[model samples]
Target: MPKIVRHGTRVGGDALSIRIVAPPERRASRGSVFVPPLIGGSGMQQVGYFRELNRRGYRLVTFDYRGHGKSGGRFFVRNTIEDARAVLEELRGEFAGEPLFGVADCFGCIPLLCAAAERPEAFRALALFNPIPSLQHVAGPREVLANYFLPRDGSGARRLALRNPFDLRGMLYATNQRLFPGVDKSRDHFGILRYTRARTWLATWEYLSSRPLAGVVSAVPALVCFGRSDRLLGLEDPAAEERYRALWLRHLPRCEVRVLADVDHYWTGTQARASVAAADFFERGGAVANALPGSTLAPRARYRDPGEAPGRKNQLGGWSRSSGLKRASGR
Candidate 1:
């Protein structure tokens, strides 16, 4: 069942709209939140993912950010945290039983990390995938807007033709801070961009700091997965993998981390396989499940029986240790 709700109190000041998928027969009472990508408010890319998660008997909630989708707002940088909080409040209000799980993608996870550090009551478990906190991609606001709204058309020319990085970015920084969200291409998320630029600098600034996520410590279980290939790292200096590992290890000791293979910064070929792994990981009560084939949809990673472990198939075609992910990872 998909239901819509007014996420705000005002009549016309601006209301957030949320779409939820209720569990089938078990009558799920717990809810999981999936934060959409920068410009993907309609969540069309996630429908298939939601369908699969619904089968797991979990109530899943997704919403258009302040400006990106059905919600009211204009585009802008820095409003990420506020929107995440608003969504969390709605879920907490609707569900009285079951755990609150959060799954954040790409730039969407920053605010949640900020919230976990500042407002811990918001949610419980979290699954963050390839969340890059630094806005080091550019220095100006116009560039920020373009990067947020531009489609990854897979065209070098299209990407470069979209905007002039140096000049536009300078213009953005020179513009007034109170009303810049309007510059972002997405009309729906513009309002939030406008409001957040005016008040959400604290989290952004802290995230840019040397310690960055130092303040965050999730009491609830957390899963942080990074694609093996991300353009974020420039060679040696600070390998992206090591940086993330160090950050989470220090701030979130209970966190579990995984490096997805055969993928790059964009997660090109491994999306389905990765999502399946993630869904299984979450549904399995936070246990670390090994990946299957290039993918596996098994609820709990039972792998093969001891006898059928990877190497020896014995007489029967049943169990084998050489066949499972744990054996490969030596887990």
Candidate 2:
């Protein structure tokens, strides 16, 4: 069995719950940090992946997004990035010598990309499953509007006045199941409907749609995998892969882009494959990058502050690795 340790970090006034799982040792020979997708904070969503990675001897760290699962503070797009920086800081202190890898799913890709863009050297490689560059690209305007009721710090009364009555994400899930047989609608899920704050939804839509995909680039090797039949991103069409290939090539030309035939947007039964792909990418190193024919590794560059981009500096609160965090729990 793997040893589990829990940590809490006060980030921008919010307390984040993070879990670190490692083989029975102080440290592992290799490790990677897992950034949960939107609605991905619960350990229930990630424990399987953790166990699978553990079998490969990789230490794993996963955290609950604020307002989701047991973490404190309201969830929002900017907060996601802030929380991610805090997690990375903690990872540095706990697992120093080994190369760190980053793995994320769906909307989690936004913050992962933002964090990686801001600190390219922080991760040795990155793998994004069913990545969404912008929610606006996938969701309808009505759904986007449903998330813009009140300000981040609005009074409860004010927030209630503007609250959305419709379960937009739930409707999306229903529609997805109808469109694709692969979506496992049978299993119950604690989806975004329960923890999604209006401010968080609005902020995510804005951040994702506004940010340039090129800025999400990294000097390290990158792998982007999505289901060929993903209804959310419309990758089912044969032309979709080529479209994404063209888009990703513009920013990260050397990144390996794979379109899995049987996978779906939710990754319902495909968790094992995703875990294995991540391990292969991190373990094989240059071999994985080399395997993507017709692409040469990009030149390594010093960490450039991605915040220098227009309107990005203050978009997410400043990042700090300062040490005032308390060990909320451990085992």
Q: How far is candidate 2 from the true structure (C-alpha RMSD, Å)?
A: 12.6
- For this target, which candidate reaches the highest lDDT against the unseen true structure? 2
**Which consecutive 10 residues in model 1 have the weakest lDDT in total?**
322-331
Decoy 1 TM-score against native: 0.59
Per-prediction TM-score: 0.59, 0.68
lDDT of 1 by residue, 176-224 (tens): 1212221222221221233332323442343245333446666655677
Cα lDDT of model 2 by residue, 1-331, tens digit:
5667887677877788887767546545576565553542353245443346667777767776776656777766556777777887887777776678787776677777777777777788888777777655465554434334422233433242344446445444433333333222322222322334325356436544565344666565678887655666765444776786666655555578776665556554456678788878778772445555343222322222222211111111111011111221110
lDDT of 2 at 329: 14
Candidate maximizing TM-score: 2
